[model samples]
Target: MARPKLQDVAARAGVSVTTVSRVLNNRGYLSDELRARVNAAIAELGYRPDGIARSLIGRKSGLVGVIVPSVADPFFGELVAAIENTLADRGYKALLCDCQENAEREGEYLELLQANRVDGIITSTHNRGVSGYERAELPIVAVDRRIAPGVPMVRGDNRAGGLLATRHLLARGSRAPIMITATDHAGNDRATAYREVLESEGLTPRVHAYGYATPIDERRAMVETWLSGRRRLRPARRLPPRRGGAAG
Candidate 1:
């Protein structure tokens, strides 16, 4: 059987195609009786409007692209979930793309989203120095990552948070607290604030930076080695050797 169309619904409802369109789109004044008849005919025929056809006419795709570094990461996962829920409430659908922190993959996803003609994009992936992003001609909201000029950005107060943490650690009797962080220029503000706070207190600031591209096990080993070295450098506390045990 042929699928039902607007013309079929109009004929079954004893109305013109214009009337059926008005009823479907809730445009113009419609009598309750006529609305009921058209709705009943649509229900009886199981007629559904084609979204793509409607979008083309309205010039609104009603779709939003969301690109993140990795949804597997808890922060990005929660952020995406919140954005999706907000978009759903606004009757917009989200097309999600996880770039997995790879720049090439991120670029590919951006192109894919543009090709799909999404209404807008919410991106948490970096696009610095990447071409084509500046030419997308779409409304883009950047989350935590800096992009081309004129692109709006949303970010947290990293510097204030870092200063607060460092001050708390100093108050808690940490003589030489160090700030450990990934070696990303995006986080330079936090490191700067940490150093500033230490300098304000007339104490030297220690910092340990690690590469994010390193494997997790290798990063952990590096951290362990740094901790061991710090421990070795600390002043030794001497205690009497045990009576019946090996002495030092």
Candidate 2:
């Protein structure tokens, strides 16, 4: 079946195409009765405005691009979902790009978002080797990771968060508490906070570092290797070995 258009709604409402366009765009003040008639006609015809046409007229695509390292990750998945819902509430569409932590794919997605004329971008990608941000014309917000100098960054305070956990262990008399961190530069703040807190308490902090990109099996083995030597430590400060990662 042929799709209904603006003319069909105008014909059913007994109005001109210009009036129907105004009603759809909410351009100038419209009487209740006129609006009701137009709305009723739209409902009956099931008419939807052409997005491309509206964008061409207003010079606004009403689309926001969202790029993430991996939507499969729980943290990033929830982040993307929240962003999508917020944009939807504001009557903007989201163009999601999952780069899978690949620099090449991220760069391509950035170009594609610009090609689609997205109004703005929210990204968590590290953009390693990805260029063009220095010359990007549109607004870009980085989440949790620093992408560029001028781009605004939104992230949690690593010091405050580290204190929460480290303080908890200290209160529990976990004198043997140790810090495990990833090799990535993003984890430097947390590691620094951990070391400072331990040193201030006059406790020697034992820090074990590992690669974040290490295979899951190798990571497990590395953690196990560290825990194997825990018996030599004291009991009152014995903190149980827990599986966790700080690479995100």
Candidate 3:
């Protein structure tokens, strides 16, 4: 069976398609009597305009895209929940893209959002230097990640947060404070801030990288070597075992 169209609704309502379109678009220039007649015709036809099709025609979609590195972290979970609620309240639907720390995949998702004609993007991705995305024509707001030059960002001051954490640790009498950060760029920023603060206050900060090395065969060999060293460094049982579990 052929589906009904706006023309059908307009014909049924005894009005022009332009009038039907205006009512559909809420332009509200018509009398209440005509508006009610159009509404009745629309309801009787069980008609729903394809949202994507309509958006393409108007060049505007009430859709927002979001990209994040991972969703397992508590911080990201709360952020996603809040973003969804806020966007929902504003009559927009959110499309989420989880890149899982894959830069190429992140780039792919960004392009996908562009292809989908998302109205705006809220991203927490790290691959900010992709030329294709850098030149993309869309509204982008980076969240929880460093925004590249010419990109608008909405996030807490991470460098200041790092310094605050480091200073708090020092004030609490931490003789040796070590910061374990993952990414090279972000870690560098935090470490640089920590160093500047430490220098001003005659304190020193230690930083360490923590991650599993990759690339197949080389990674296996490195893991085996680390396991062997760990075994060798195990503390030896120096004294005889005590009879009681509580010890004398």
Candidate 4:
């Protein structure tokens, strides 16, 4: 069956199309009796307004785009969930896009979001330059990664956290603490903090940087090699025996 329209509701309500439109939009003052009649007619006809038509008329899509590296990652999954909940509270819908750590795919998703007339975008991936983002002409919030100069960003204090972690290890009698991380990461603030804390304590900081995009086997081999080298430099020390027995 054909769905009911505004004209059908107007005819059923015994009112002009203008009156029906005004009632639907709540534009002008309306008599209680007239409003009741229009609402009753709409209810009787089971009429539902077309969201796309309304969005086109209002020039707002009521959509917010969210682009992440990959939803498979727990961090990105949690981030997307938070964004979705916030958007839902604000009466906006989320258009989620996973770039899968591909720069070209990320750029394409950005264009797709733009073409869809999304009101804004929240991105956690910034592999490409700023030009792609600039062309979107929409409000953007960068997550963890800095984009263009004008773009706003939200990130944790990684450097402070790193410093705290290193200090804690040092206090616990960790003579040679090392940091392992991706080599091509956009920022090295954490590594800098780790180095600074180690240098302040008159200890050399050891860092092992690996390619994040490499195959799992290759990464495992690299890590194993680094660990073997470290073991050769400083063998594991035997702990003192406990009062009751040897410590497990």
Query: Of the candidates shown, which would achieve the greatest TM-score relative to the real structure?
Result: 1
lDDT of 1 by residue, 12-92 (tens): 999999999999888999999999999999999999998778777877888999988666555677998999999999989
Quantify all predictions' global Cα lDDT against the true fold.
Answer: 0.78, 0.78, 0.72, 0.80
Model 2: CA > 4 A from native: 159-183, 186-188, 192-248
114-227, model 2: which lDDT tens digit per residue? Answer: 877788999987546688776788899988777778899999997677777887898987876777664335446766767666666666667786543445577678878787
- Which stretch of 10 consecutive residues in model 3 shows the poorest summed lDDT? 239-248
lDDT of 4 by residue, 102-142 (tens): 88888888898888788999998847553577656889999
| Cα RMSDs, all models | 9.7, 6.8, 10.8, 8.5
Better of 1 and 3 by lDDT: 1
- Give the distance in Å from residue 166's predicted Cα in candidate 3 to where it truly belongs: 1.3
Poorest lDDT segment (10 consecutive residues) of candidate 4: 239-248
Show the colliding residue pairs in model 4: none
Pairs with steric clashes in candidate 2: none
Task: Report residue 102 deviation for candidate 4 (angstroms).
Answer: 1.5
lDDT of 2 at 107: 90
